[model samples]
Target chain A: MKTIESRSNPLYKQLFKWQSSAGRRDEPILLEGVHLCEAFLALGRQPQYALFDQTRITEPHLAGLIENLSEEVCCLLPAGLLANLSNVDTGQGVLFVVRPAVATLPTHLNANMLWLDRVQDPGNVGTLLRTAAAAGITRVLASTGTASLWSPKVLRSGQGVHFGMHLHEHIDLLAVARTLVVPLIVTTLSEANDLFEVELPVQAAWVFGHEGQGVSQSLIDLAALRIRIDHAQAVDSLNVTAAAAICLFEQRRQHR
Target chain B: MKTIESRSNPLYKQLFKWQSSAGRRDEPILLEGVHLCEAFLALGRQPQYALFDQTRITEPHLAGLIENLSEEVCCLLPAGLLANLSNVDTGQGVLFVVRPAVATLPTHLNANMLWLDRVQDPGNVGTLLRTAAAAGITRVLASTGTASLWSPKVLRSGQGVHFGMHLHEHIDLLAVARTLVVPLIVTTLSEANDLFEVELPVQAAWVFGHEGQGVSQSLIDLAALRIRIDHAQAVDSLNVTAAAAICLFEQRRQHR
Candidate 1:
């Protein structure tokens, strides 16, 4: 195993940038925890290098897993230093640095998709990604005000589903409207047809908006339809992620 | 405005206990932020007292709202001191201490309900409550291990919907199961009938478990039915709140 000590190790600086704001540099993404490392490899993606805390690999299971990684891609660091690489408490002791997967918009699209408009919370953004992937609606377009998709907080909450989808961030809603061949349906709580009452198009693009605001005005105006899921009348509306799931699952339900 | 200065003041101590953990005292439940205060009043509930930060309540709208809160219940504290009661970086500078509303279980119940089995994270617990209320689920029973239903974190995430639903926490699942007349359905990702393929009972009790563990074994065994929501095969499962929304809405969908 190769050792890298000191935060000034150019390598550590690079890792920090990649972990916090990989989108800024178009560089390798830093994935922490054994689960994510396994997910990355499971997707048949190779990492630039895998780091492990030599002192923390005492558990037979962890040791065996670390030993399996080829020496060429293995780098060892002190346990405390490695822990600093993770946001999680009692760190997972392993990390993988991989190139961000390229996301291409399908030239001829028919499948349902998800569009996020200015959704700021990283956990909500990431959880939406996981929900999108799980619902098999993989193509996601996020607007400029949305949280950066490649940030570590999003990745951790996303649980490695990044490899499963085509995510395009910093997208213009007008550009999407011009290119999309299917109905652009926006989910809102007010002045919309009940989701159950409306006939969902077999293939459409669904838009969910910011926590505080409904879909941005421009996008809502361009929407072919607006649908609202009926809940208890007293409460204002559903949480963004909850609304996303209900909408995505409704789409799935219709197709199924 | 009546003043409260010293942290050692007995009134401040009582307020702190109510804000952080009041379930033990069977006393007043605290509400924070201007939105929650408005909701509580809109529901026709009166708080024992409303507290505001002298310095932070500058916005005309906020000031007017606070002024309308009735002089009998108005209490003022210094800005920094009031901010200490909040978890957010910038406090909203308003809090209401309302007696916990008595929630009575329905006799000979026919409406669908949701149950929380030791779901511990305050955010998840709160979000679940919000989801349940929005989905027209009025009755919720939570296990003893679940986070206190009225904790500030849960209250904030609930976004004022806590008042719309009947939340009974620190409960014994076994006792509820014995008393429930509706079919109890436990959600699990493991072996079970696919949610899409199965016939969902329009009026039933749905159990969502802790984050790491799915539905507990005893609850699973006691359940009248076990259902699994189908997601993309690669991912483990959806977030519990997302899962709850899907399940509850599916029930609503079927009956609607």
Candidate 2:
């Protein structure tokens, strides 16, 4: 395998771009650690290229992974250089340059879908995606202000669910709301139906809003159902991800 | 108000110590940002001391908080000095040194409680605490290997729910399980009843395990109920916090 020792190497500079949020767009993003790499490979897709830290090549898991990849698409880098591109504290000693499958918004948003209205935190966004996928929902849309779905932090928090999901970002949610045929369920803080007591539609578009602010007024005006998860008054509200899990799973529990 | 201009100031050093996980034990931990400070004050608790960045002290929220505090216990510091002790990216120009209420284990572990088994990530542990509190489960126990409950990261992610929870850390689970009067609900991967189909107990101790490992074999053996959340199977499992929310809220729904 070829070794890249210098920081100034062209390939190293190209890989470095994949580490930033801006770099994540359009370009193939870097997938770190064994879990994500394994997830990507499990989807019957191949990485454009793979990099392994020379120091960890002998490790059993890393070695087994390397043995599977063709020699041309694999390379070795010194530990320091590899660590520089790693977003996590402990570098996993491996990264795959792979392009995520581009997804298109469906004409009818009728499935049990999730619409994120500017969910800001990367972890929250990622966790919502994972929760949605686990609930067997295949489609998700995010407004412009939401965290980028493919950012490294979101990817790590997502824990490999991104592969199985069909995600659309920078969405015009208002426009979509106008034409939507399914029940539009928006979570509100007050004066709404209780999530548990409400008659949930079999398939609907669920909207979760910004962390600090609840769903925007325009969306609330358009909501076919405005529901709230009733909790003790001691705490103001549940975390967005936690709320999503409860709401989605409750819907699942009812239909099951 | 007193002004602290030097990094060599003893008070600054003491505040700096509270920034680390090791410093959180048996000491007044620092509470950052307006939300957390407001949450603490809402509990009708006074800060041992409060610090504000000199540059942003005139801002309305900071000024308002300062107005309510006794001048003797509040101090002003340069923005740089204040930022040094901050754990979050954007410093809110304020910090409160408050003592968390000490909690003792009650003889009866009979409440609808959550037992965290070696949950490692501070974010996960904090989210779990926040979720548990929102679900109206006031008591939570964390095993020894779990993240430090009072660490700065956990406290930040917890979003002031720490003030409402009766948390006991460094717990011996097996011993607690033996004497536990209520049903012990443990989540497992296989050969268990489905969470949705199972008849959940009205009052039980819910056990959520480490991120990678399910509940320990010993604990699983002792479980009164072994349950697993049925998902699409495209992903491995629900996040620990997500699972806790679903289980706790489901119990709430059953009895509601």
Candidate 3:
């Protein structure tokens, strides 16, 4: 029921700051739109605050979402203010600021996971997470050069899968590779086994790298297997997200 | 070299118009960055005009690219002018205006093809085209509701694959589906065969629909088979581009 009209308000300034760049590690991430908020609520995770556009709050869908939230967490913002806080051109009229659940990496990795080495595009990083989650991979590790896992663009691209998975960012991937109990599968451009021809391991860490500069030599040297997705020779390489989907699902098919 | 420093100039105005929206059917499409330009040249196609930033034209890479073109086709623009014509934040200092090669739809469709039904996102549409090309689907048809395939953002995301593919826009997909010789495979959310378990046709028309909406009922009714990619129940569905990659590559794998 609280209405914040001034840009100078402490809460509004904090929201604005969090929307721009990677905030402090512990800061609650900004989740935009009804779908993401619904996803968060489905996980039984409560938002620190739920901000809605005052004019559009009476719309049936937005009102339905409001009824599910605790009255204490709801706040009203003018349409302009709400739009300004949104990353997309058309504001979705609702936003959730939720602190993600903290996760710790296991000492000895035995499960199938994803290692993103400098996957700079936020959309690519987020889609990879979504694909990894759908394919039943529960943990994902990203090097420092990777896009911020909690960035707004990524959260939008990731849809709601971030809730059900363990995400470790700014990781020392090479060090982790050295300590892994499972095979490390690296995808490369050439001189690698065709993905369809190889016998994939049941549980391994799949390493996908930067868009232009692929898997680093250190990780390549440590890979238990190197695979490439064979395509018509016209394309230089598959988009990272596409490659991830094909590889992850192919693994699923093999195990099935 | 001719210098274009004024925004009011006719040539500059024409380039500006082409950059903003879908131009006339016969208008030349804009190709940005060195990679795209190189791709265009590799096809043995020359741009109607190559515009470069005056100051950056002397850079080694740009200069080398310049050597391949006839001096009559080149023009220089002030940095500010050239940057204004770019879509990305950092302009690559080059842009090409070239009329795309005309393509006609075959009356009796037998080859593997892609039918995009109201796939509105430029990035998604473009990425789909690139994926189709890489998977060896030579022909792509898009309904009117789909994003303009020749738009700048689609061209950028498509990389250079547009040059090699036969792209038909503003299509009546239902009409085409009715006359198809090969099977029409529709991707659906539920009540469909699992993609991996099904016997995929070697030559089929794969229909990927809008982002939020699955394939239309009309298309679904005409489908020889409806297939869905099975994934974890936690997430709603795979991103369209990701879904296309999985489906296309799976077909390729089975055929091989």
Candidate 4:
């Protein structure tokens, strides 16, 4: 029956710290809204701490969630408190602080994966995670220049499916490149085969680069194949998110 | 040699009107930033009116563009004025009011097309247009509930490629469904075949739906085929933009 009323409370201050991208730790990140809570529960993981909106207790779905948590791990708070913690206007009414299980990338890359280099937009980064997971990508590596992988915006955009992913951020693309054994594909505008005409490897990595620049030269040098989406000659290029989805699913299409 | 400092100046007011979606006409929409200006010039289209940032005059690229404009069609404005006209923080220091050629969607719906039924996110709508144009889809028809095709946000996300596509907004889905001459594909979560397993038509229309709901029931009833991307069974769905890209490119892959 403990309740948190003041923003200055020790627990509130700590949760606030975790909410920021810079304050995040390597093990766990803040999980916002009901969808993420469900994702954690579906995966048999418990939130270290849970906050509930007094007003939403009547919601059967949320109510069922509250019933399952131990008394020591959950608390009821003002709806306004929970609402302010989120970036979106209508924040989903629950919040959880959960530690994710550790994921280790193979020393040598072999499976279908996505290597994101300096893909800074949070929405694009999040959508890429969702799409990569949907395309059954085995892993996703975000170089140091990429958006903060565990930031709230990235989590919200991911719609709570990060649990199923072997997502590693702040890694070095050059280090990964040295160990990659499969066909390494990087998209470029020149000396490229039309994406449709090129048969994709059954298990290979698709590296998508920054919004302004194509793949970094260091990684581009490692690419066994450089392909381009055959677009209208008048248009410059596709959005990074669109390009990633088309590339990943094309590979998935070939294998399936 | 005249400058407009007053917001009430007739031309300034008119340009402001075009900045909004509701005030849009059947004529050309405004293109903001340097990238869009380059796109228009690259296509060899003359701007009806152009505005330059006084601060950016020394930039070599802008100087080249200004040199190309006819004296009657272009003017220089304070950097502040040009920057305020855009939604992005760095407004790229150039703007154009170019009249694009008119395009029509056939009543018969024979060609490859994208029928968007209430796909409301502006970014999603803009990305869809970019993808459809890249896939070489002939026309895009947006339902009445869809995002305003000419809104400032859409225009910015669209990156001026809107100029190359036949984009129509606030259209009826039923009328379009009735006129179908090819397989009308709708994406849904249930009783749908795996997207990859099904061979997509070389030339056919794909109808994408809203963010929350799938395609309208009325339109879904008219669909000759319902296809879904095969993903991990636990996750809810892929973002609508990702779904559209995967489906369109799969068809593109088959034909190529």
As for candidate 3, its interface RMSD to one decimal place is: 0.8
Task: Provide the DockQ value for model 1.
Answer: 0.77
Q: Compute the lDDT for candidate 3.
A: 0.89
RMSD of each: 2.3, 1.9, 1.7, 2.5
True contacts kept of each: 0.84, 0.84, 0.78, 0.66
Order of the predicted models by DockQ, top scorer first: 2, 3, 1, 4
- Global fold similarity of model 3 (TM-score): 0.96
Candidate 3 per-residue C-alpha lDDT over A128-244 given as tens digits, one digit per residue, 9 for 90 to 100: 999998899989999989998888878888998888889998899999999899999999976799999999999999999998898898999999999999999778878888899
lDDT of 4 by residue, A164-223 (tens): 788887788888788788888999888777788788888777889999897898888888
- How far residue B237's Cα lies from its native spot in candidate 2, in Å, is 0.5
Compared with the true structure, what per-residue lDDT tens digits does model 3 show for residues B1-256?
6779899999899889887754347778778899899988888878999999999988987997799888888999999999888877898899988997779888889999999999988988888998888898889999989998888888888889989888898999999888899999999977899999998999999999999997899999999999999998868999999999999999999998
Off by over 4 Å in 3: A21-24, B22-24
Model 4, C-alpha of A180: deviation from truth (Å):
2.3
Per-prediction tally of clashes? 0, 0, 0, 0
Residue A250 of candidate 3: its Cα lDDT?
Answer: 99
The pairs that clash in candidate 2 are none
Score residue B51 of candidate 3 by CA lDDT. Answer: 94
Q: Ten consecutive residues with minimal summed lDDT in candidate 1 chain B?
A: B17-26
Q: Give each prediction's DockQ, rounded to 2 decimals.
A: 0.77, 0.83, 0.82, 0.64
The runs of at least 3 residues in candidate 2 whose Cα sits more than 4 Å from the true structure, single-residue gaps closed, are A1-5, A21-23, B20-23
Best by TM-score: 3
Which scores greater on TM-score, model 2 or model 4?
A: 2
DockQ of candidate 4, scored on C-alphas against the true complex (2 decimals): 0.64
Q: Write model 2 residue lDDT over B1-256, tens digit each, in one string.
A: 8889999999888888776633255788888899889888888778988999998988999988887888898999999999898877898999999887889999888899999999999989988998888888888888889998988778878899898789888899989999999999999987889988987888999999999996888999999999888888778999999999999888888887
Candidate 2 chain B — worst ten consecutive residues by lDDT sum? B17-26
User: What TM-score would each prediction reach against the true structure?
Assistant: 0.93, 0.95, 0.96, 0.92
